[model samples]
Target chain A: MYRSKPWRIFQLSGFGSPEEEGERIRFLLEHGETGFIMEHDRNTGDHLYNVDHPEVMARREDVGLTGATIQSVRDYETVLKGIPIESTYGHPGGGVVQHGPYALACYWTVARRRGIDLGKLPGTGQSDFFLTYLGCVTKQQVPTQTGLRFNADIIEFCAEHMPHWVPVSIAGYNGADTGLNAYQELGAVFANAVEYLDEIQRRGNISIVDAAKGVGGVSFRVGMDLFEDVAKLRAGRKMWAELLAKRYNINDDKAQRLRIHSLTAGSMMMYPQPLNNLVRGTIMALAGVLGGTQSLGVSGYDEALSIPSEHAHQMSLRIQQILQNETNLCAVADPMGGSYFIETLTAQVEEKAWEFFDEIEAHGGFLNTLDSGWLHQVAHKNQFEEQASIDDGSKIIVGLNAFADDVTPFDIDGFKSSSSEWKHALERLNRVKSERSAKLAAEKMRDLEAACRTDTNIMPAMMEAMDAEVTMGEIGDVFRNVFGDWQTPISV
Target chain B: MSALGKKILLAKTGLDGHWRGVSLVEKRLQEAGFLVVMIGMATPDEIVSAAVEQDVDLVGLNVGGHIEVVHKTVDQLNERMVGVPVFAGGAIAPWAKKELEDRHIEVYPPGSSLEDIVDAAFRLCRINVKASTLKIEAQINPKYSADGAKP
Candidate 1:
């Protein structure tokens, strides 16, 4: 008797002050979301800068628009207030490579302070290469090599400490959204997996089984191409299993099992027909479920206009709930399995993905392709082609290009978060700096710097820094002074 | 001045580094025979200074932030480079779009066609030929070379 676990409705939730982010997470959870993702302010979080950083200060208005401005453990505590971290499966920001340690350490430190066992904490860390190096390249980040080291260290740390925690999740959603086609997304994702697993194997600290398991929980973007995306996901799992068994020589079924988190494409949410996105989200999400995704996050209807409003977030969760309850989707395992058309498409996607994987290998490796801008070029080519197709009318978006009529009922002035986000975040940063033990914070920062310089796992020092109440900018300064900026390959 | 040699200064007026929108616009403008100068993620000061220094015929702002940032950039451009047309594209909400449009800034939100953007560029720059039709002419004519088209 096979019992299917209903796919977890994990929504990416954050914005404004820490308290506001907490409130949004709580709202989603109340609305039947199984897991919550903490989104840090892209200005501060993605670049690891504080609100006061000059680059951030230039566009201070954009600070909390994308996510919450979390600078210290106090902010983390504020965001996690009343949220049960012990039971909840959380994704604590750090989608960028350099920010991963700080995000994980802050979340882990929060759990520790709450008397929650670190080993028992169930959550995931996202130091996604595609996000950091490829998709949304930050102004300042450590080089790809350093990022690889950070991921490997994270893997080892999670293996030693938090067994239930997914140390690093490779997100192909970033790549696909940036422009990689379905097969390219699959290939690059597996190539990314190899970078982590191989680095862990070379380090020889943790077993290959643990490393494989750590890297297996990956995410992909399920777009409007329903059957194609479904095929891509199926191919992803098969390729993962084959890579693990053949190359790594690992036979542990638990390690070989690929867990997928499918996110609906935010890029596909057209601004003209904003309400139509709910339908798009449904179709994309259905593709995810059919592809056997373990978890799913539906993009909001207002995604193209702004960050999701409260109603938009609710609608996203309700879409998943209806699919889970009304559709009886969980009654059968691999609902699209055994179909001749689906099977052939899956095989073709797999074949193409391996070819792309080999191409990555030919270009040195995944890290090198990022370092050399090869992957960015590939994504850019597809991005331009896709845009061209849309431009020439070869591709027709419903209300955007064809059937250009607005019959929608309401006017959505995209959810504007608290305009005072920067002010509040600055005030908190000053408070934390003034109140925290200066000597202790400095000591911990030095240790973090040293950890970055040496082969030591940076997580311990990062945890101490979080405990000592170090700010994001201070850590960013240390990284800049130590690792230097990754000469961004693409001009984006 | 011919459309072929018109210099367009493109700058992202936010710290957000997602460059697909700007890059696509840049590609279209370049292919339309405009000299596209990209100052990636610049402040108002940097944008104005670059626009003046590059002697760009038109200024394109990739507005990914609050309308205030774009307003600031436009204000600076107006003060520094008089009569230079400004247009933008990105996640400009409806209200922001209206505000920019009110200030004579053409706002192309997501789903706006590249051909339309190129056409707007030509019209704003006061070029006689339509950009969509000028591509083949610019390509075939030896006198329409990027450097030769320069004033």
Candidate 2:
């Protein structure tokens, strides 16, 4: 333990029952994981719907397939009860903008109960627009404007309370995976962050400087493009610093220095020789590490399947650990700062990114692109074109289109699915209905709706609603009343 | 074939909107001579209603979330109508794929060939799957100032 100079190798893991999911998290940490990510079931979490909601009730069995079913803070406490959250950096999966506040508040609320002050807690939450607007466009979400407000609120909340927390990380990684090439990823992230910073300044509560620093920690997707991805990462840091100086005119060291976390692109993993994805993972992880990232989450070999199996999750962690320990990658910082190709690519990414950023601003900014379905089309155009290229063999995916054979000895199927996860969710849903106070839940929801309508920050009301046992369905009703559903342009 | 203009109800079972696989197929199915009713994203109820109201002969499910979610949609489809062939795609992990197949549902992952899907559409639509492959693919200009929204 003399040299704790290791970057925490993090992996997203959690599916099935809360106990089963918690066991997997504990197992990863026991092996070598320095950090953990708690993934909530998407069907319930992303839509902010309870199991009884007509849509959720239709397919109640799909409830916990993606991740554990956690309806209340009590459910969160069950999943994280034994984990040393204070010691280990914890990413409570709040990947959706609408869902993130509830997820983070629940995690922080759990920590508070364990006597952990909010200030000492260290972790980042992802409310990635790339995921919501581009890659995995949810069935329903607040309009882009409401989403910006939510992210801005979180940034300010963390600024005021939890200095160690990175609030609402902008995950360009989601966009890149969805098919925005390297430069587009760079540009979109800056454009997205501008939305956040501008919103914060408009609120006039927090300093633009502190909000910039708080939201500056972003995440990117680094895949097989070694030099290009690495340059993107390095360029991201300098671009962020430059953005701060240009916009807020604050040269505060922390505000300028951008911190980054990277996840290997899930789309990069090929289904044809599943074992080859291990090599793909290594290559992508190398791209991230070489790109000067502060943290990394490599895609598992069987990523195209369900959530990572235990072995797959472990191997993902081990891939990063090997890179950290055996490769001597961490011995220096920004090691690829001045290669001719890298420098040129970095500049190219920055220049092109600024162009896209200008485009987003011209379109009336990030929210406008989202609201008008402009950004969705941009991502759609990229996605279909990328697929067409792959189909026609114009863009080669090794082992997929080109080297379609496998002589490897090992066998790997994607993670096995379970129908039981859904059963557990229904049981929990029934338990919550009978256990909670009906009157208190109603009052809290009313308060939340009022708070959402007024200029007041909704997190405090959300925390209270959650504490009073308000179900996600009730909260969703409030959202529908206040923000209404976004009319999406794409038929996704 | 007697079913010359049989309707094919195509809908996304999950809110996760990935249009490439669904949209391309919708266009191809329509071009290959099927009535492709593209209901963007719907819960099971909406899908069933559209399927019945349109009197569609076959259902295509674009699944983007947990497979369990899509299964409920399929179950509703079966419950609402009889003998309607169902096919699905998108993020259907091996296990989910297997389950869908077990229900005699045709499953396509993302990388499945467009020809194969068009061929399946022909089988379901009861038409000679025409040889005309869908040639429309999006092209990106280097100087696109803003994104263009389209249906």
lDDT score for residue B75 of model 2:
78
List model 2 lDDT by residue over A4-61, tens digit each.
4655688888887788778888999999998898887777788888766777766666
- How many backbone collisions does model 1 have? 0
Q: All models: lDDT?
A: 0.88, 0.79
Residues A217-285, candidate 1, lDDT per residue (tens digit)?
Answer: 999999999999999998998999999999999989999899899999999999987889999999999
DockQ of each: 0.35, 0.42
Q: Which structure among the candidates has the greatest lDDT?
A: 1
Top candidate (DockQ): 2
Clashes in candidate 2: how many?
3
